[model samples]
Target: MGQKVNPIGFRLGVNRDWRSRWYASPQEMPGFLHSDIEIRDYVKKKLLFAAVSKIVIERAWNSIRVTIFTARPGIVIGRKGAEIEKMTEEISKMAQGKQIKIDIQEIKTPELDAQLVAENVALQIERRIAYRRAMKK
Candidate 1:
């Protein structure tokens, strides 16, 4: 038998870091945590077709910063960054008046990312491609 460890948990503070960077006061902790999950879910659902690889959320006094890592940055960015602007507005509403900053980061090698790779394979299969052929390539 082998021990199992979560990749994200194992890598935290090493190659990866905490999502919520700042500490919240006890009175504000619940609201902050709730807003974090709400923002994450809303963004993920809105960008479902954007080949999102990972989402990083950080908090500061009076503001939230969301950095989205995606295999297809252009989709999330849209023409003239319109998509991001709209997303920011939506997230601001979800945050209940906190300022929100959205940043998009591109993943150069989608194949190396497990989520991107799986999504790619699933998309190919949906388009009638053979799973074996897709995986073998």
Candidate 2:
């Protein structure tokens, strides 16, 4: 029988890496995992317009570094960097007071990003554009 496999998981170690990098004790693993999940979701929902493509979480000692890959860095950074500052504070709370450092990376060629291309198509469709026209772009 045919089976479906996660493309990312299939490529892990071959050419891909884990989105999260951390070492946690058995008793604390679950909490850390859940916190990672919540932080990811919170960032995505907060900056939905930012076109986030990937989020990499790296933890060491008592600090967490959140690297966000997005097509729109300005939206994530906001005016005067206020948005990112607020975001960092919120994520710190999510990490239970651990330091949160947010690093936003802009996608140089968003046209090649599958997520960005798909989101563009969806937005065109939402605007009542024909499917064929949407795909053409």
Candidate 3:
């Protein structure tokens, strides 16, 4: 018989030697792959969210509100707004010939709104005697 070779061993050696050293271990390989995929997915999702958020907030508020809050608007607006536009477009695409309405409020400060809303909600939830019933009360 000809020289016998372990196919799995050869394959493993090829995988270990031919690939980049950045992924050093077998355990690290999956992590590296997942991270790469995750980053791409995150970027896409971020763009979508930004687009939808911008459209919603813009539709909900008038030019005056936009002008007043322009400085802090960037946070809600997101990077390049490409993602935001992508998100809005995706929604519209899903609706298929019908326009989707998005409503977003433009607070003086978004960061502050979150803090205030959270605090208020917590207070309502925590301090309210009837809890659920008193939440709206």
TM-score of each: 0.82, 0.92, 0.27
- Whole-model alpha-carbon lDDT for candidate 2: 0.93
**What lDDT tens digits, residue by residue, belong to model 2 across residues 1-137?**
98999999999989888999999999999998999999999998998888999999999999999999999999999999999999999998888899889999999999999989999899899999999989999
lDDT, candidate 3, 34-105, per-residue tens = 543443344335533222112111111111011111213454445875534554565444434234333234
- lDDT per residue, candidate 1, 1-137, as tens digits? 99999998999989987876779879999988888888888888999999898888888878988999998899999999999999999998888778888988999988899888888888889999998998875
- In the predicted model 3, the residue pairs found to clash are 47-83, 50-84, 51-84, 51-85, 56-104
The model with the greatest TM-score is 2
- Model 3, runs deviating above 4 Å: 1-72, 100-105, 109-116, 119-137
What is residue 49's positional error in candidate 3, in angstroms?
10
**Residue clash pairs of candidate 1:** none
Winner of 2 and 3 under lDDT: 2
Predicted structure with the largest lDDT when compared to the true one: 2
- Residue-pair clashes per prediction, in order, are 0, 0, 5
TM-score ranking, best first: 2, 1, 3
Kindly provide the TM-score of model 1 when superposed on the true structure, using C-alpha atoms: 0.82
lDDT of 2 at 50: 88
